[model samples]
Target: MSSFDAEALERAAKAARELESSKHVKAAVELSKREQNVKVREYDARKAEASADAEKAKAAQIQIAAEERRKTIAFERKAKEELMSRQQQMERQRMREQDQLSRQREQDMLEAKKQADMERDARRLQMEQQIQEERLEGARRRAEAERANIRARAMAEAEGRILEQRKNEDIHARDIQRRSEAKAAELRGAIQEAFSQLSSTLGSYIKDSTALRNTVFVGTALAVGVYGVREGSRVIGRVVERRLLTPALVRETSRTAGTFGLRQRMKRALGMLPAEEVGLDGIVLEDKLSSRIVETASATTNTRRNGAPFRHMLFYGPPGTGKTMVAKRLARTSGLDYAVMSGGDIGPLGKDGVTELHKLLDWGETSKRGLLLFIDEADAFLSSRSRSAMSEDHRNALNALLYRTGEASRSLMLVLATNRPGDLDAAVTDRVDDAVLFGLPDAAGREALVRVYFEKFVVRAGEDAPRRLMGLLPAARASKIEIGEGFTDEYFAELAARTAGFSGRAISKLMLGVQGAVYGRGEPTLTLEIMEDVVQRKLAEFDERRRLAKTDYTDSASEAVTGTAADAAARRSSA
Candidate 1:
């Protein structure tokens, strides 16, 4: 009913049960009641003591809060006083600064006024001095002007007197010059008259003397005859050198044989001529071969520059292997004049071969630069002397060549080309300084050649193509050749493989065949089939030629064997 705790109620019930079970039940109940009252008193005392401690702590907290508030108020009051004191001090400093600035301004104004007054006084003094100086200068200038006028008048009078005297002297000199000229004219007239009389007397004597007139006529005729012969011989010598010394077998040359016309000169200057004609542009060879050739060319250039004897060379190769082409290029690169001759041409000359050969050598001797004498088919005439087929005239011609080439010549370089190097005379072989071999093209070289020729003949076949047939016509009208999509570098490599045994000239001819085949077609397009047909035809032709050449060689060998047997039988019969 009073909202007592359950624990206290349970403790009362337990005490009542214990008293009911006890014998002294009234006493147990009275003791439990006393214990409960005592415990209640203790609990009240502890609660009162805790309330008193909390009140004391609350009072202590109130006192601490009051102290902190008082300290905050005192600090705020001190800060306010400090701020006022600083503001008052700043006001005093401002006032003092204003007073100092006013004093400085007053001083500056006083100094400025004093400087202005001093400048004004100085200007006044300067003006007075300038005026005094100007007065003195004006007086001095007036005196100088008066004196200058007087002196000018005196000088004018002196110049006038001198001028008059010079004029009189000039007049006297003119009179003397006139007299001298008149005397000189009279003397000249007398001298002319004397010369005229003397000429007339001499003319009359010359007209009367027949012997003297004959002598004069003869002397004049002799002089004219001498001059005519000298001029004629010079002209003939040039004609011989140009026409006769240069042999007919010279298929092409880079030397300036005669004068070039203006148009030709313009074309050369504009680079219209083929680069191969002037340099080593179109030549294709193996690297090692080309290197050796270049070394020889450098040696030749050095030899020529040093004024040393020109070295003779031999180019041994199969037919159409570029020996002749290299010879032409060598002459140009060596800075030497070139003259090409065929050795076979000497045989037909009979007795005149020696004379003609001599003339060629003599013409070579006259070259300011050395002459490169390129003899193609050299073995045709310069064969071994042990052969019985050699004619007397041929032998004599060979002897003449041997004699001329025995010693190194400063004016002549001998370059011999031959397919049959073994057929060449030992004497001719001995004269060679450098020997170059032109082997067949290898696979890579053949590939390169294939590309080069294809570009020239197919890709570039147009009006830009080189002129042919003595340079009188174009090789093609326009680019009518078309390469197929299948025609690539691999195709060209296959083509090179097909043309394994072909020489450079043979390859060129094969391309020419390709061109012709294209032109023969209606559309003039180079299809793969057309190229194959042309290549097959050329290959067949090449095989036929090779077979024919082999047969000919065999027949010649048999004929020689039979002829030898016949000669032996004849000799035995005579014995």
Candidate 2:
């Protein structure tokens, strides 16, 4: 029963347990085969013992013992051989795993070297790019320095030449002064001699004709007084023109094209200063279309494919929606020289309209500053040529416009504004680069316009700004129309909301009406009720105008239909 015996099942079971714990599947399988072989040998031993007993022969028993010994030796040899074979196979497998691990490590090392080389090459390229950039920057700086030095030298030379010319001018001026004084003295002597002769003749007339002497004396005295007055007025006129008008015009001119044309001076007299007209601010930008057009024009003014600015644009919208205002802003924000003319003004010139239109285009081109020619109510003259009512005058003007608007001149932009875009000739629309629509303001726009009008017309222009900007005054100026304290931005917003269909002009007019109503009554401040009453009146007026326009359109269409039917009947009767 000792486990030391080869036939013990406990010994085989211990070996099997050890093999399972070792977790070598191949070794476990070989142990299981050996266990089966042992079972077969035990069975063979039992069978041989049974056969010996059945025969009851001693020789047979002895033979069976010898055979069993031989089989034990063979079984021992086979087990030893299998153990050696399993050990050799395990050794070979372990070496293969070690070799695979070593190869993996070598591959990882090689990949690391490749990544390091790539990083080094990238760093080298980056350093080279930096060095090249530095060199280019240094070269640009040196070139700028050289240009500045050259400009300095040229300016110095110009200044020296200017100084020499000024000295020469001074000497020439002195010579001219001497000659002028001499001529003045000679003229004075001649005037004295002529006056003495005239006095002698008048005295003889008095002595010879006593009846007419008093009348002649009075006439001579009156003539001398009139002559003195005329000369004095002439001198004053020259002084006023030189001292007052010239400097005033010069100051105003500095803001414009450096000098004023006669027409521009006339325009200034009519209270249309270009700078003031284009000086609108945030409130004017409440309309999205207007602001977008203004912003687009300003942004693209200096854009370049190769090189070019914004070309021509068309502004079409309802009346009082600020087409002309947007055009002026576009011209101003782009810093272009602005010229304004109306199509209505041009149409009255008959055949001369074409000439005047060409003159305008020529003037714009002649001024080196870029020109923005804005024509308001353009449909008046730019009407379709195919229309029955197209006058010869408008036809000629349109032809000239087509010629001038071919390709925009150097930095010249033509802006046309029309309340009736459908009336505009196809040729005009085709020449225009961009057309922006400006419709009536919505709620926000109305409120902004109201605020702008109130602030501009009532607050600032009236007397209230004195209190707001410089603290409360002792008394308002006599000319000031004071704004009531109750009328605030909220009041304006409410009034604006009520004014649903009113244009900007109508809102401004409402302000004007309130001012008139308040000022005529001699009230120092305007009440909110007064403002509301004025707004109601304006709204009524606006409604009336709309109704009239609709009625007029309906009447005209019906008349056209009636006239056409009558004409057709007349033609049938004639047939």
Reference-based TM-score of each model: 0.54, 0.46
Candidate 1 Cα outliers beyond 4 Å, as residue runs? 1-251, 257-267, 270-272, 275-279, 465-476, 550-575
How many clashes show up in model 1?
A: 0
RMSD of candidate 2 to the true fold?
Answer: 35.9
The lowest-lDDT stretch of 10 consecutive residues in candidate 1 is 551-560
List per-prediction Cα lDDT, in the order shown.
0.81, 0.69
After TM-score superposition, the amount by which residue 544's alpha carbon in candidate 1 deviates from its true location, in angstroms, is 1.7
* Model 1 lDDT tens row, 446-552: 88888888888887787476665546565667755777677888998999999887889999888888888898888778888888878987998899988777421
Give the Å shift of residue 179 in candidate 2: 53
Which 10 successive residues of model 2 have the least lDDT summed?
246-255
What TM-score does structure 2 among the candidates reach?
0.46
